[model samples]
Every structure is written in C-alpha cells, then in structure tokens.
Target: MGRIVRVISKDASVVCSAIDGKDIVSRIEEIHKTSAVVTAALGRLAMGTSLMGFGLKGKDDSITVKMDGDGPTGALICVSDSMGNVKAYVQNPVVELPLNDKGKLDVRGAVGSNGTLSVVKDMGLKEPYCGQVPIVSGEIAEDITNYLAVSEQVPSVCALGVLVNPDLTVNCAGGFLIQLLPFAPESAIDQIEKNINGMESVTKLICGGMTTEAIAMKALEGLEPNVLDDFEVNYRCNCSRERVENALISLGRAELEDLSKDGGTDVECHFCDKKYHFTPEEILGLIKE
Candidate 1:
C-alpha cells in the first residue's frame, strides 16, 4: 500500500510539521504513464499537496493546489484531504526533457520557471481560504515553501524529490516540510536550519529504505515531536462519463444541436487522456432534453 507519515517536530521554542509521502507519490506517478521528467514533477507536486493537506486542523478540511504555467506541461493540479488522500494530473504529460547536469530528469525544464502556485483550503464553508504565490523554482518544494511564507505568512522549509530510473520508471519519491511556529526561539531555529541543510537528499533516504517516521525523526533529532498520525495514499481520480456529459451539455442547446447535425462529438479528458465518443443521435437527444 502507498504510505504517508505526518509528524510534529518540536524543540523548546519551535514546532515543525513534516510529512513524507514516498509511496503515494510513486503510485500517482504510475498513472500518468508519461515521460520521466513529467512524472517527476507530477509526483513531487502530489507529495507536496498531500503533506500540506494532511497538516490541516479540521477533521474534514481539504486543500487543492494548482500550478498553471507557461510551459509545455500547461498546468499541474492536485487535491488532498485531511485523511491523506491525493489526486493530481498534468495538462500535457508527454513532454520529455534533456537530462540535467546531474544526469537526472530536469523537472524545472518541463515545469517552466514562470507561473503561479495557488492553494485553496475548504473547511466545509461557503467560501474557502485561498493563497497564491509566484512559482520560484518550478522544482515544486521550494515553490511550496515560498507559498507558505509569502502567501500564508508562515515560515517554512519544504523539500520534495523524485528520482526517475533510466527506464522511465520511478525509483523513489518523497518530501519533508518544516514549519517554524510564531515566536519560536532563536536557538531552535538555528538548530533546525542546520539539521535541514545537513540532511541527506529526501529521495535518497527513502530509497535507502528509511521509513517516513524514521526520516522525520532524523530531521528532528534534538527536537521532540509528538507523533500525530500515519496514512496510506494512492492515485485517485473523480472523473466519470457522467461528469463529462454534464460538461458537454453545459455547452447549451445551440452547440448540442450543431453537434447533432454534424455527427456528434468526441471529448478527451485532460487528466487521464481518455476519450469519450458521442453519437449524433445521442447529441440530438441531449439537445432536445
């Protein structure tokens, strides 16, 4: 099963929240079935969203993250609930990138350096809280941290990573988020910063067989964190033929009539790249009804 762990790391003057969602990212990567770089970016974003979403307070609270870029990837979107459930997709997932200097998938090249990352939180309210920040690194983790600091006014350190195999498969994927609560002590901040800078690559740690709990613990060594919860997540989509039909019907009677006269229509899902066909008769019926 896909695994995800959330922990609250605290020292005398600071409290840090860290989430490691390795397996869940990998599972989502599998569904995209795209190029290595695309999968890496998607996986990283998914992991980041899951981590952030799981950090919410209300039992039924949820968060949605959207990245609409000027790059070939077009847009990257993901949603996560407090229960650690996450779903995400890219508008164009077939784009590939030349290997970077490190001989690894170049996620920034695929995601583009220009765009915006927006987060919207739903707390079962009439209007959800929204925050947006300009994309900083396109690498995902840094952008998330930037969102927290600039948009939400929260000081945070977030790191997300995904290693893609030469065969275009995922080797490892995970991330950690460290948030500095308000009025945290200076020494606590210094130690946590040192720990973060000295820590090994998150992907390497996870691929090396480190559990999520263990990774969080190592990052929070001196700090004592009260374990909150652990959860398993996977790639899931809420799309269906019914939803597609509703969208098409929303085109109005005129468009439906035109489609009926022409030979119906064909629609493809941007998320899953699946197509649905509609017959002319069906279009006519839709227009009539």
Candidate 2:
C-alpha cells in the first residue's frame, strides 16, 4: 500500500508530511490516460489534499480541494480524509501543452495563472470551515503553499510533481510539505529554508523507491524528525447509487413524478468518473421513504 508519513522535526520545530503516491497515482494515470498537463495538475492536487485531509482528528472528517482555473484544464477538484482516502477529477483531462521554458510539463500554462484555490474542511460541524486564496501560481505546489501561509497563517513549504513519460503514462508522482511550528526561531527558519532549497526533486526521490518516512527524514536531515504516524492512502470515492437516488428524491415530489413519466434519471459523480442511473421506480421508492 502507498503510504503517507507525518514527522516532527525537533530542530526546526515543525511538522512535516510526505507521501509516495505510487499505487494510487499510477492507477489514476492508467485510467484517465491523462495528458502531461493533466497528469501534473491532478498529481499535485492529490498530494496537497492528502496532507490536509490527514490533519483532521476525526475519522469522519473530510477535506475538499477545489481549484477553479481559467485555462484548458478548466477546474480541478479533490476530496480526502484523515484515513488517507482521496478521490480527484479534472474537468478537462485531455488538455495538452508544450513543455515550459524549463523543459517541464506546462502545468501553469494548462491551468492558467488566474483563479481561486479553496479548501473546505468538514469537521462534523453544521458549517464547514473554508479558506480561499487567489492563485499566485498555477504551478500547484506554490499556489497551495501560498494558500496555507497567507490564508491559513501557517508558514509552509510544499513540493509536488508528476513525471509523465512520452507515452503519456505516469512514471512517478508524489509530494512533501514542511511547516514551521509556532514561534520558531529565525535561525531554525533559515535552516529549514536552506534545506528546502537544496532538496532533490520529489518525483525523482519517489521514483528511486524512497518511502514516505524516508523522504520526510531526508528533507529534514538537519532537523532530526521523529515519525508520528503512517497511514495508507488510496483513491477512494464515497458516491453510490443509493446516494444518487436520495438526491433525486430530494429534488421534490413534482420532479419525482416527472422523472417517473420520463422513465429515469442519470447522475454523475464529480469526484470520480462514475455514472449512476436511477429508474423511475427507484426514485418513487426513495421519495416515499
């Protein structure tokens, strides 16, 4: 199973999370046949959401990651939870782009530099906690790092990457996040920054078969972190046929009757590329209950 590791760096006085999305990301790349741009974008989205999702305390808690981009890739959304379950989809998974000036996947060009990145945390409260920030860079990792620092007031460094082969298959995908603890010393912050700037590419590290815990330890070498927990992360979706039927029933009695006359209804889950078809009788039964 793919794993996510959380560690506390005693020297930097910070908490860090690293993920090797080997299994989950490979499966998604195979299923979507995503273009290079889409692969990079979705890969980063999955990594970022996984970090945030596992930060919650409750098993029932969940987090939603939404990026409304203005380029060919359109919008991207992902949902994840403390259990390390994540599901994500892109509005246009076929968007293609030439490599950027750096000779890398043109994620920014495909996602556009203008948009909003929002995170909603569902902590069993009636109202979810939401934080929104304007996209500083459509490069994903930077955008999310800014969102956490500016919007959430957490000093964080994020690195997310996807390596796609010429054959349009994923070679590797993963991410890492390092955050400073409250009132960390300036020297500690400087050392952490230096470590981040000197670090090797995250994708390369994962492709070399580095585990999540090893990555975290490598990144914070000078910090000497203590591993807190390790969790298995997978691509999981909560949508079901029953949930779709309940939604149709909630459309009201008139809508149910009209659907009965029309035969049935079709509903699609945005988080996963799954379609649920409901018969008129199913809708009526849901409404009666």
Q: What are the models' TM-scores?
A: 0.86, 0.94
lDDT of 2 by residue, 1-289 (tens): 5689999877547888998776666666765667777888888888789888887899899999999978898888888988768888888889867889998988898888999999999999989999999988899999989999998898988998888788877788888888887877887787777887887899888888887888888777777789988888898888888787777767888878888777887888876668887788876777664
lDDT, candidate 1, 33-136, per-residue tens? 77878888888888888888877889889899998877788899998888667888888878866888988778888888898999999998999999888888
Cα RMSD to the true fold for all candidates:
2.8, 1.8
For all candidates, what are the clash counts? Answer: 0, 0
Kindly give the stretch of ten consecutive residues in candidate 1 with the minimal lDDT sum: 10-19
True-vs-predicted CA distance for residue 13, candidate 1, Å: 6.9
Q: Candidate 1 — what's its lDDT?
A: 0.78
lDDT of each: 0.78, 0.83
After the best TM-score superposition of candidate 2, give how far the Cα of residue 281 lies from its true spot, in angstroms. 1.3
Question: Top TM-score: which candidate number?
Answer: 2
